[model samples]
Target: MTDLTTAFERVELPLETPFTISRGTQHTAANVVVRIEDGEHVGVGAAAPSRHYGETAATVEAVLPELLDVVEEAGDPLALDRIDARIDGRIGDNPAAKAAVRIACCDLAAKRLDVPLYRLFGLDGERTVTSSFTVGIDDPERMGEKTRTAVDAGYTVLKTKLGTDDDEARLAAVREAAPDARIRVDANEAWTPREAVDNCEWLASYDVEFCEQPVPAEDPDGLRYVYERSAVPIAADESCVTLADLPRIADACDVANVKLMKCGGPRQAVEMFHAARAHGLETMLGCMIETNAAIAAAAHLAPLLDYADLDGSLLLDSDPYEGVPMPTGLVDCSALDRPGTGARRA
Candidate 1:
């Protein structure tokens, strides 16, 4: 049996570009990369938790010591099993950190076995997934100009950030700029129930695909109201963090947005996907600001869902490790055919 042990390393890579939003700012991305090594085999996972989801670099950093101990004690053969068992309760409410460790272990395990991570989930290697490029909060003209650039770059889908005074104009500008591109909007829980419903209705003029997290997470009733009133579909982001949140969220949401960080790990994400499907909810795979490792893990789940928002890595100026190469709004899953996550630590 491989003697698996977990190790943590911090990486700081500049964004090939910077992504700005209403929440705050991110320059060079910082993430903690977890490595699970069992003798000759190694698995890698990377995670970056955002403040919008109630996670920060300092918190992820502080949690690593405890995670290392958990991996060391669990050993290689049972490393993932043990990690899965304690992930939810021990990690408190921060799913992002636990997800990072889980991904690393899976990557290491698959690498050891000389197989791809998706194959472990019983998925074939021939699936292609399309991703969405995000347009952060900015001036309407600038937002429109960015949208035009992205569209010209061959991004078929665009996700625009809203939560400020200029949201209406921004949406209009982007629509005018990228007339043929599929558009979606995410409010990041910035709107109230009424505001969400009202804004979503206004957005209908542009024919948006859906509106995500229109209202605050805790306001399920408000979400339901927005869903019923809005012309476009409503996808729940902050509102649906766990399986438990699904039932309540499903009542109000037309779709569920699943983020590996918010869902805990790949295993839990799969579980949630199953539950969301069972509830007859359309599903979207979302991501936080992360490296290719986390983005790759999330991409594995995209083939199993209807919508994907795993473009977080593209917003970064530089990716430290080479795993899955992101081509704008689509994922080149050709790399996923290899063993592990196809990520090589730098």
Candidate 2:
């Protein structure tokens, strides 16, 4: 048997611009990259911890130490379900940590088989989807400038951050900046039902594609109320954490935003996809403020989703790694033909 071990490092990615939402402002993304080595092949994965889901960089680092023995005991990396169950049995609710290990396992398995990660699940990378580049909350003029810049760079879709008294002005600025680009808004769970519906109606006039987490995450009744009355479709981000939460929020949201950091990893993220389809809910493959590892891992599954918000790496000032091909909002997934998830330290 090969000696298996895991290791990780924390890197701070400086955002080009400050990202603000209902919660707070962020200038840097504190992300952790996990690596699994068997003295033969190596697997790698990365994740950005969010306080909204109760995980932080420190916590992710702390709990990751336990996964070494678990993965060593699990043995085969392609035994996806077995790896997931074994890790789950050892650890409790640290989804981000579990995600890192699961991603690494998949990467190692794919490299061992000398195939792309998507090939393991019978997926196609040719049919890629357009991802949305986010413009975080800022002064209307600044946001408009950012919006214009992104559009000029060939991004056809834009996800604008809202959740302030300036939302009206911000939307107006973004609309003025990119009249022809498809628009979506994420309020970060900041409004009441009435406020969300009223805002949605107002947003409808701008031809906004959808509103994400318009109301607070814990208020299902409020979400349902907004879903019932809002003219714009509602896509749940914070509201849908795992598969169990999917059924609960299906009636409250038109779409579910699945992040591997929030769910376990590829194995569990796929479960979220099927569960969303079973519930007749639209699916969006989203990401945290991440690097190429998590983004590339998610990219392999892009052709199977209704929407994509995998621009986390694109928002960085200087990315320390390389994996998938990202040309603005487009995902040139042919870069994924490499073994494993193709995320390598640069």
Candidate 3:
């Protein structure tokens, strides 16, 4: 057994701009930051809970004490699997809370071993994917402006939020703004299969890389219907939450979009990525509006992803922590010059 101390606190982070998706608009993100200390080293992580996944800052805060207790009781940050199994046994859900703990443990484990998080995972820092800067739902003109701003900021990839009434106009505006950037679109379960199929045709015409979650997660058949007919590739975000979801969504979508909050944490995300590949699906990692403490850990898994939408920290007005550097939207693991996940107080 080892000595481990743990704590968590909730922070309200204002968005750089109001972030609007298909469901609603968010002015601020409520994140619960978790910290685990083993005498000399402190491991940091954060939970950017989503109501769409049935979690909020309140839910994450409520469960974190118990989760941290499990970590403290385990007393071994390196025993990640044991601690994770215990957390799952204690709580039936609250993936974001569990993820915060798991990320802390992973961070501590890597730091104790005197290695970067990716090095611990045996991932080559050289092999990496560029992340996509997301343009949240806004008026077409504003969306165009956001696209232009991102392009000027050196982002080569962009993900535009859709599911609006005038999605075509919005896409047109973004395309006009960033004509050469690699673009992707997310409808966020707002379309019927018919509408999705039709939208995919236009998405393809605009040179969109993929269309994400056009139908509701509950409608597996509808997802498949769109997937089988869509001119643009389909990526399953809402439908692909856990490892068990791989087989279910494999034939229905071409890509699997996994998030740390939805899947538990880094270890679980690694499992899901391998499983997604086994199921013949391209792997992607997405995130909610988050701080660097959360997004940094996710960035270490970049070597495993075919696509990445980890612009969560970038969307914040300011963050107290810093993680891996994503220069011009690239998940630049090569620039991680510190141990652990490179998440430290800024």
Candidate 4:
């Protein structure tokens, strides 16, 4: 039997570039890398928080020390499961931070068993997953320039940040710049029920694939109104966080965006996906401004989703871990066959 110990390390990685949006700014990612060392093998996991999701570097830093005890206490085959159950709603910590700890423990366990993360979860990681590169809210000219740059860089799917002024112009400019690429938009809960319908109609004219969270998450009536009125598909982001919220959103959304942080961890996310599917909603795996560690864990579920927006790592200037590279645009996950999410030390 492997003798495992849990340890945490802080890492600050400068973005190869900076990604800005309406909510705030992110220049570098300060992540807590969790390592599960069991005698000869080691498994790693990472986690970070986003300001939009009400998380900060300081919050993650504060919570990680508490996790150290949880990990040490549950040092067995079912350690992660036990730890997850014990910490449920008890941590008051950001979902992303907790997810990182869960992922690291899982990764370490898989490595010790000589299996890939996906395989441990009964999945095949040798699948190709395309992730969308997000283009944040900028002037039409800048949006167009960013669109062109992403398209030129081989991104086949593009998601534009909407919900501010001149949304129509922004949509038009992006469509003109990347006419052949798959396009989607996220309002981040910025649109009104009527405005969401109107804008969806306008965006549909430009061949947009869908629009995410057209209204605030609390407005299921507004979501239903927009869903019935809009020309394009509606995807629920902030509105669908847990399994309990899935059924309430069924009529209002055609898809549910799943994030590890929001759902607590991959295990919960997978459960949410199944629940969403049962409600006739498609699943979309998404990410906050996280590193490859979080992205890697989420990537394991890509093959099961109808759409994905896991481009959080690409927005980073540099990702600290090495796993499978996120393919540009609508990933075709037919190539991920490695063990334990294919994550390697970077």
Candidate 5:
């Protein structure tokens, strides 16, 4: 077994524009990066600390040293389930921090095993999803402009934020700007069930592929209510945090948007995808406004995704780390073949 040394850093990734959801707006993504090394090979991973999950960059940093200490002594990085068990049993609900550690460890193991991270999970490198660039909540004109720009930038799919009173106008504007683009909408749990049904019916005119988190995270019954009345497919984001939440959410929505930060890491994410499928719900690999390090780690599992909203790194003004490349607005796992999770300090 290789003697592993682990370390972490807090990174501030400034977004190109402020990202707004129903809960709030974010100008910068406060994330944490973890690195695990064994003499010759280096593995890197990152975490997006979500406020909705009650996690912060500070909390990840504070929790990591203690957590990593346990892993160093008693855990086996190569036995992923053991690693996850160790973290889960000891660490409790800090999914983001546990995700970073799991990512770094798996990255290191993959490098040692001399295979790409995808191969480690028995995933096909050829299968992948085109990532949808998110256009945060904005005025109709501004959102339309952003949609046009993303379309011109080679993005065929556009996911727009819509929660406020002007959602109809915003969707209309985007529809006008990128008439041919596959559009998806995320409400971030801002509407009442009745309001969501009304919006979903109105949104059908825009050809929206799906509506995410249309009601508050706390109310799956409300999502079910929306599901019963709306023509547009409802996808659960905040409503589906981890595998534990799936049984309930699986019945409430058409799809489950699984984020690695919420699920723990790529390994657990794979589990969530299958579990979602087993429960007859589709899956989308979602992300917080994150950096390349985290996004690349998640991309390794792209073959299993029905949809992807991995434009997190694409939203950054300048990312300190670079991992993988999306030449055609879709994650090309071939681009991430270098080693490990393909994340490196830029």
Candidate 6:
């Protein structure tokens, strides 16, 4: 084991536009960035918290000192297994905080090994997936405009926010704007089972690829009800937070949407992906509105994902860091020229 040093800071990132979902809206994202250093190398990570998951930037900031203490005590950036276990032991919740520490450790470890994060995981950098750019909830015309803008930006897939009274209108506008784009919808647990079932029927008519979190996570049966009756495939975001959720949500939804913040870290996300496959579920990776400091690390996991919604940093008005390059929404991990998750000061 070697000596390790750690620190954290909070950064507020403004979005290019106000982002809205079934839950609410925000014009800025609050992220807490973590750094772990081992004499020569600094590993970077950030926590993008969600109110829906009971975390905010304040919560992440409050818990990080204790989490960083765990890393310092472990004293070895490469000792991920020990550090990860100790972190979980320190805080059973506060997943975003834990994730920040985990991501930093991985980044530092990869830097020490002098390899790209994907190469460290023995993944094929050539095997890639295009991330879906999101169009947050807006008026029908605005939604159409956003869809057209994303398509013009070369995003081949788009996920739009729905669950409004005028969901059909919103979707129709988006489809009309990007007829060839693969469209997906996320209701964000805003609909009841019956409403979700009815919505999915029309969602399929609009050629939606899937419907995400149609019913509340609190009501597992309601999710299953919608899944069993819906015309489109169902993806569980709120319902599938950790590996334990895989078994419970396996029969209820077809896709398991894993977020690094929700799962605690990259390792945990890998576990969830394999577990999801075991349960006959497709795997997807989603992100909160975040900085490239965070989203860059998640990009390395693209090969493991059946679908990637990692456009978090792309939504930012500006990012202080640059990670992997996603030209036209294609996550080109192989194009990463440097190691350590490809995150560097921009």
Clashes of each: 15, 0, 0, 26, 0, 0
lDDT of 4 by residue, 1-346 (tens): 3366877777787765566555555678777777777676666777776666787667877787777567766666346668787666458647877887788777777766777666677765455557788898888998899999999999988899987778889888999999998898999898889888888878888998999999998789999999998899999989987778898999998999988878778888988989998988888998876677777878778767878888777777777676655555544334545556566666
Model 3 ranges with Cα > 4 A deviation: none
Of the candidates shown, which would achieve the greatest lDDT relative to the real structure? 3
lDDT of 2: 0.88
> Model 5 compared with the native: what TM-score?
0.97
TM-score computed on alpha carbons, candidate 6:
0.99
- Listing every candidate in turn, what is its Cα RMSD in Å to the true structure after a full C-alpha superposition? 1.9, 1.1, 0.7, 2.2, 1.2, 0.8
Write model 5 residue lDDT over 1-346, tens digit each, in one string.
Answer: 5577889899888888888876788899988988877788877888899878989998999899977876676545686777677777787888899888888888888888888899888889989789888889888989888988988888899998988878899889999999999999999889999999988988998999999999998887899999988989999999898889899987689999999999888888988999999999998998988888888888888899899888888888998878777875678887665878888878
Candidate 2 per-residue lDDT, tens place, 226-295, comes to 9988899999998899999998998988999999999989979998999999999999999988888777
What shift in Å separates residue 276 of candidate 4 from its native position after superposition?
0.6
Please list all clashing residue pairs in model 6, or write none if there are none: none
- For all candidates in order, the CA lDDT equals 0.80, 0.88, 0.94, 0.78, 0.86, 0.93
TM-score of 1: 0.93
**Residue 254, candidate 4: C-alpha displacement in angstroms:** 0.7
- Residue pairs in collision within model 5: none
Which prediction has more favorable TM-score, 4 or 6?
6
Clashes of 1: 15
- Cα deviation at 75, candidate 1, in Å, is 1.9
Q: What is candidate 3's local distance difference test score?
A: 0.94
Q: Which ten residues in a row have the lowest lDDT in candidate 6?
A: 118-127
Pairs of colliding residues, candidate 2: none
